[model samples]
Target: MAETSLTELLERNARHVESLDSDHFAGVEDTQAPVAVSICCSDSRVPHDGMWDVTHPGWLFTPSTIGNQVWDIHDGERVVDGSLLYPMINTRTNVTLVVGHTGCGAVSAALDAVQNGPGMVPAGIEKWVDLIVPVVEAGLNDERIDADRDVSLVDQLVEYNVDRQIEFLLESDDVPETETVYGFVYDFQGVYSDERGRAYLVNADGETDVAALRELAPTKYHDAVDRLLQ
Candidate 1:
């Protein structure tokens, strides 16, 4: 038989669940445990479990959506509030991660929509992209930044989107005041970028001193957590 596509593979696996070992279902009902919540893009390539393993280890609670935009209102009416915000506030997971990526189709489409016109984007998509337009505007307004640089302005916009989303998360009532939140950009190569280069962690709070983070003894990641804890 020919190789199966991922969807088909998943379907096939689901069919074989009855014959699988008992351990597959063991401890499956443990719902009280706390987890680190990660809000990432809906892109299939960006696997949250694998990314967190390389960056921050152990169990995590992850929520995903296209564009990674978390807004309280939807379609001019508050239908869903913010997706991950409520969970962060109510659940044991206090830490939240807003992960963005390079070459994001949504970000690129939004930039194009702003430059040209909404064109083919439907009303819902247009509304969603509108949440990220300010980041694109910020990237465009930065004189020292070149839109055509090696990483491209769109990539920078994606990074900025992550930062802005973090701000949105912070401003929401659903996010606990004491909780720690982080933002990062996952590049096309799966590398997270920061001012410190391919960093796995980037402090979304603009107040963090980049120079001090770079000079930390153990690692920038550790120092970032320390700063937040302080």
Candidate 2:
């Protein structure tokens, strides 16, 4: 099965090469100034570039990790991961977008780890999940979250997690205050609304107020900008 999938991948790459124009990436070959640097969960369902309909190579800089975590353990300290920082420092990328999706397996694992004591897992996977466990614990303490409710706990945790990640980004000295951070929860389970696959703006520069978020967005998306926890 793996061999078949690998063959399909090569064939798909051949088709992609055939469809490309001569100058398709010529403009960005030397340098790149992407619209935004997006950090999202390592989920197969979420397409970081496709969400923005970005086909051009240099338009979006994507750095993904488990649980959509911005920080990684390095030498016994949690620091901003290099994959997310390298683009901002060199590519003139200012806008930082942190995207979390509903039904995130990472967040679910963290929730379980927090509630039931962590089960033994691979060390690398445990690192990311361990970071998220505290966020889940904090979310549970917040009045907005409920283990049982109309909105599923996992979905609510996903939104809360997005906000937490943005907060971490904002507080980091490594990240310039001049850079704007936008947090979004990509809804695919009809949890935020009936519109599946809609990326809802939940936080901007640490502001989670729905009214403020609506104002931050274009008038057309005001109704769409929503926070599940609130």
Candidate 3:
């Protein structure tokens, strides 16, 4: 069978969007209240809406970046203080999720950078990949991390990157100390996963425990756990 051209694919997809009722916008326009804000990677495989579907429905405001890493600046009153963190905080969303993903091209490139030097990749991509190198290095130092297996290494890197981005979000002023923050990694299959199978949670200190935290605070903790994985 012949593969459809890019133009044909896009034209078909555009028709799908145009078919939606204009009234669909009106139904959501007045209800701008977002219960949570999700920060995830630019990976097309991980859809924010689909992930959030695991939880009860409410409008979720999401901000996506290439690497899902937030950079914090001290000495400012900025809410959601990081570059990608503010939108959710400004919305005063009850929860914030920093989401990374497995098999990320950016992380892979970053690993390549460390192995082959930065010259091998483009300049702009190198900058984004640089953000993840520290996590790669950390994985390298951890005895449990398997540097030999590409899948294991990528998963570890994704988890570590989520932890780092969550820490960055926590530093933001918009993120209340009382407000819950989460870290998650979406796998290639679009299923969220932890160290176990699919989907896990990071505690306030960024430790993974699916059961313990759920037992402590059912509602808030479960929401945090689910959203992070999403």
Candidate 4:
């Protein structure tokens, strides 16, 4: 198979842009009025639009970064803090979602860096990946993950990191208590009833109770919810 050239890629993109009709954006408003703010990983497979089945442009205030790690680094001067605050300030959004996924390269790289040591993966990149070192360590300490078992520590860290990120956001003074925050895990392995890449609610409004979380999970994911609670 021939590799697609930059010219071909640009032409394809231009064609797509030209094909978009006015009707496609007819319902979109000029003002920033979104239902929720979504913080997710920069993984290509898990696009924010598909998570909420978004059809309109302003349905979600999306901010994606490496591993979707949120922290009070540098006294709230980091990009993650600004990204979360931007939607809250500009949009009429009441819900905040911290989403992570299975098969996340960022989480895996962070796991490797923590287990071993930060290697030559560029100075800035290494710093960003190092943010999840605590998460990786927590996952490693979890009694559920046995070294002899087939469990992927990286996947465990992904879910745990989402919980930690949500915890950080909820504790932030900038985040109003009126706004609901949720932590979710996007399962890409069809683990939830053969539906690939479905968003499963792990934490709702800072509550991680199994029963409360079970109430939020879709009926199709009831079995998966049991596994998550286990």
Best by lDDT: 2
Q: What C-alpha lDDT does candidate 1 achieve relative to the native structure?
A: 0.63
lDDT of 3: 0.63
Q: lDDT (0-100) at residue 59 of candidate 1?
A: 58
lDDT of 1 by residue, 1-230 (tens): 65669999888889877566767545535543347678878787677877656333335767787687766465675332355765676566777777776678878887887788766667777766776676677767766356666656676677667766777667666567777777666655532324332324444443334455445335635533322111
**Which residue segments of model 4 deviate by more than 4 Å?**
1-3, 26-29, 75-80, 191-193, 217-229
Pairs of colliding residues, candidate 1: none
Residues 1-230 of candidate 3 have per-residue lDDT tens digits of 76789999999999967876766555456556577777777777778888767332347776776677565225652234354444454556767777777677777777777787875567666666776777677756766556675345666677767776776556656556655776666655443433332334554445456565566556744744642221
Which candidate number has the best TM-score?
2
lDDT of each: 0.63, 0.89, 0.63, 0.76
Each candidate: RMSD: 5.6, 1.5, 5.6, 2.8
Superior candidate under TM-score, 1 versus 2: 2
Show where candidate 1 strays beyond 4 Å.
Answer: 1-7, 10-21, 24-30, 54-58, 74-81, 190-199, 204-208, 214-217, 220-230
Candidate order by decreasing TM-score: 2, 4, 1, 3
Q: What is the lDDT of residue 4 in candidate 2?
A: 58
TM-scores of the candidates are 0.74, 0.96, 0.70, 0.85
Model 3 residue-pair collision total: 2
Per-residue CA lDDT of candidate 4, range 1-230, in tens? 65889999999999978877777666565566888999888887888998788866778988887888765367546434678777876675889899888878888898888777877888767766877777778877887655564546666667778877887877787777678998888888754347776787778877877676778867766655533424
